[model samples]
Target: MSIWSESTQSRAKEILAKYPEKRSAVMPLLYLAMAEDGWLTIEGMTEVAEWVGITPAQVQSVASFYTMYKREPTGKYLVSLCTSISCMLLGSDDVLHAIEDESGVPHGETDDEGVISVEHAECIGACGGAVACQVNYELIEGLTPEKGRELVRWLKKARPDAVNTDEMQELFGGRRSFDWAIQSDVGAAGPYPAFEPYGTATEDAK
Candidate 1:
């Protein structure tokens, strides 16, 4: 009856231990929830709030502020096409339409089957690879309308082990592995709380 499975809950403890305070793990825990459910469901956020000693509303506020976190269900693969200035000039708009037509899923929405979700991204820092598209955020550069269509089809049919590309490997590597606790360092000093540092990009330019 809990949003997190027993194993996931155990992992949450590990995540908590990494920080000086449980609350510091909120973002990673949110990612854990998203990684587990493929999106941040209400129940998932509630569970994370409980784990991090925060209110559900606080969790929701943080989740809503971040574009990377999805509040609804997403397909197994999330395909994001960049449509920024450079990408737009390079025909990413056509590429986006091609994917939309082929998948029959509109931008910012997932298909009913939950196999694919499509969205337009501002700039994924790949202007050199204009018309860039990513499958689950793994870069797939050098895209054309036709190539985008084929890429989606390939993703829908490709088997995890049958693939050898680094992108494919990373995308499927931990599709179901939600063991965030294992990566924590428990020996560190207590109160090693995580902090979100804020600084302007130009600050380091001098």
Candidate 2:
């Protein structure tokens, strides 16, 4: 089910040795594999389980528990707008709708052309940014419905190969791009910790 490369598989094997809780290594390994393959396949997670001396079930559970591990293919630009409470109160729902209108894609699914896909997440730890998101792994904050539309247009123009919009080329690219993270207490009060970075495969595990 995994689509990991030979190098990644070897690295996962090496990193697993240093962990007492094999589950602790699942996230980072999935991230590295996804980074290499652009998606995490069932086979890929299973391979990680094998390397880590754990069952495939354990890996699957860990992968499914976290939203950061992508189980499907993502677009050239990943627009992860925050639709959580703070963002919702700030009109993030409208922002999400505008993005959907522009891209013709929905949550948890990729577009037909795979240009830009949306993944809804709870507070990206930027309540101050309010309705902000991370695009292409780059954090973007200070979101508005108009600004969101402008972003969709800009990305379309920047990568014409990624979308079908001549109008995008006409839109302004440079200007006030929003800040990524804002100081906020929203993420801090969340049930889960936000600083949980995924594990990656290392040479020692192999």
Candidate 3:
């Protein structure tokens, strides 16, 4: 049986059609696969290889090269705290420790409940924002240690189906890289494809 659902397979066909060579569609197809499984499973990679006319090893090579691709299973929310020079100077390390205290896990580990995964990220291009982090790639800037702890505590307690970026920024953000448009009800569960969570009412409508 194919790893892709019918809709995903159809989408894959459309993505493949965009490229002259099937192998050229590997990246997008991998994104689709990741969106499907929430991570890059061996079976999904094999199916992608079959679709793209490439070896599974080749698919693995490409997937490994990209930081966005989640090779293992991640929690429902992936929290990436920026620890680059700018964020570091602004006390991101303290924020990270606060998050660790609240989430009960160190960076690069998921909480026992599997609700949140915390990791330290390199520069996420929000230097102007200083201390910044992303929840499933949605930027939240200007976090202090207290705010970080509060954010994690809220996430654990609320377990919200949709995490509104605008709302999060309004509540916890102090500085910003730039002015962002209000995004209502938009939520992300991963780092790729920029889509709402797969089975949400928003995604279902799309």
Best by lDDT: 3
Q: Write the per-residue lDDT of candidate 3 for residues 58-92, one digit (tens) a residue.
A: 99999999987788887777889999999999998
| Candidate 1 local Cα displacement, residue 102, angstroms | 0.8
**Tens-digit lDDT track for model 1 on 1-206?**
45777766777777788889778899888877765676778988998888887899999999899887888888767788899999899888999999999999999999898878899998987677677776655555667887788777876776221222234323322222122233311110100111122100111110
The local distance difference test score of each candidate is 0.67, 0.61, 0.80
- Where does candidate 2 stray beyond 4 Å? 1-14, 17-23, 160-206
List runs of model 1 lying over 4 Å from the truth.
159-206
Ranking by TM-score: 3, 1, 2
The estimated TM-scores of all candidates read: 0.75, 0.69, 0.88
The Cα error of candidate 1 at residue 70, in Å, is 0.9
Better of 2 and 3 by TM-score: 3
Query: Can you write out model 2's per-residue Cα lDDT over 79-123, one digit (the tens) per residue?
Result: 778899988987889988888787777866778776677767788
Q: What's the number of clashes in each of the models?
A: 3, 15, 0
Q: List candidate 3 segments past 4 Å from native.
A: 182-185, 191-193, 196-206
lDDT of 1: 0.67
What's the residue-level lDDT of 203 in candidate 3?
A: 33
